[model samples]
Target: MALRRRALGLALGLVWGFAVMFSTLWLLFQGSSGEIISQLKYFYLGYTFGYEGAVIGFLWGFVDGFIFGVAVAWLYNYLSMKIYR
Candidate 1:
């Protein structure tokens, strides 16, 4: 079966964006900055363990996930077409 790149990208983008935003909020509520959350600042510029940071993380995550999902779907479709032919 062929995968739709746009659909996969959109799905992944939303999921990843929400995941990052919520995780950040959760940590903020807990009053502790986890190691992983802190490390995210390295990858996502302007990201911190704060309210604004959550939005930044979400945006970064969405873009990152979308690109990754699209690439994977494209590769899968291309390889499937080649192998099935």
Candidate 2:
């Protein structure tokens, strides 16, 4: 059951990270998406997409999202254990 819980946490964390990356970019770069597109460099992972943010805002947001996701997951796990126990 712990594995399931951890998996759920991880999935949620990833989604949150992507969301944060996109939304933050939009909010922060509203009206400048095109201006930042030229700065992006598409990246790929093993048979998977890595980073493909064309806009600077999105790229920045994407990175922030990754960080936020990890932090959020950690916080979630910690809080779950602390409060539930």
Candidate 3:
């Protein structure tokens, strides 16, 4: 694949991830705290490792964001691959 293609895919992935995070958070917030507390706990479970817990939480959340971004790229690549194949 060309560099341009990769760059475009990455950009699209970041955008898709941002949208998904926003939508998911919005949906989660629509209900009372009692309704979504457990989900948030599970969502942030990636932060439960070593080091300072709070910093770990923030950093892990950043990672989660990037992974979500990559997922967007993955979907774009999938579509491209399908079309080209």
Candidate 4:
């Protein structure tokens, strides 16, 4: 069966986006934002270690996850079709 790329992408994006937002906020409130900032900085340049940075990270994560999920679903659907055919 073919996967719905857009639906998969949106679902993944929202989940990942919110997860990043909530997790970052949690760390910030818990006074552990520094560690996450350092880690994210290593992966994402110009990432501030504050609320603004968390918001930016959330957006980036959402876009990244959405694209990834779409690609994965597309590839799976294509391969499955070929195999079944």
Candidate 5:
């Protein structure tokens, strides 16, 4: 079965974006700075452990997840076509 690239991308983008946003909020509410969360700033520029940072992280995560999902789906389809032919 072939995977729909855009559908997979969108699904992954939403999941990843929400994951980052919620994780940030969770840490913020807990009143502790997360080491892992803080590390995201290095990869996602402008990201910090603050309210505004949650939005930034979400955007970065969405783009990153979307590209990764699309790439994976494309590779899967390409390999399946080659093998089934």
Candidate 6:
């Protein structure tokens, strides 16, 4: 079946964004520290290591996931068409 690119993109965006938001919040609550989390601060616009960071990470994750999902879905559809034909 052909993938619905827009719907998939939105779905992935929301899921990934919320996941990142919650995970970051959870880690902060647990007082966790890591290189990855620190590095993520650079990827997330306006992200720090606290409450505001979660919000900023969510937005960045959403945009990043949406673009990635769209590209992946398009590529999958293109490849599937080629293979089937």
Which residue pairs clash within candidate 6? none
Which 10 residues in a row give candidate 3 its minimum summed lDDT?
A: 47-56
Q: Which residue ranges in model 5 land beyond 4 Å of their true spot?
A: none
Better of 2 and 3 by lDDT: 3
Q: What is the C-alpha lDDT of each candidate?
A: 0.92, 0.47, 0.50, 0.80, 0.94, 0.86
lDDT of 6 at 78: 99
Per-residue lDDT of candidate 3, residues 19-51 (tens digit): 445544554456433343234446566433222
**Candidate 3 Cα lDDT to native:** 0.50
Model 5, residue 30: C-alpha shift (Å): 0.7
What's each prediction's clash count?
0, 0, 1, 0, 0, 0
- lDDT: worst 10-residue window of model 2: 43-52
Off by over 4 Å in 3: 1-39, 46-54
* lDDT (10s digit) by residue, model 4, range 21-43: 77778778888847645577676
What candidate 1 gets wrong by more than 4 Å, as runs, is none
- What is the TM-score (0 to 1) of candidate 4? 0.86
Report the CA-based lDDT of candidate 2 relative to the real structure: 0.47
Per-residue lDDT tens digits for candidate 6, residues 1-85, read 8898998899899998998889889988888884467588777768777788889889988998899889989999999999998
Off by over 4 Å in 4: none
Distance from true position, residue 77, model 2, in Å?
Answer: 0.5
TM-score of each: 0.93, 0.38, 0.37, 0.86, 0.95, 0.88
Over the full model, what C-alpha lDDT does candidate 4 score relative to the true structure?
0.80
Candidate number with greatest lDDT: 5
Candidate 5: pairs in clash: none
Candidate 3 is scored at a TM of 0.37
Off by over 4 Å in 2: 1-54
Model 3: per-residue Cα lDDT at residue 6: 51
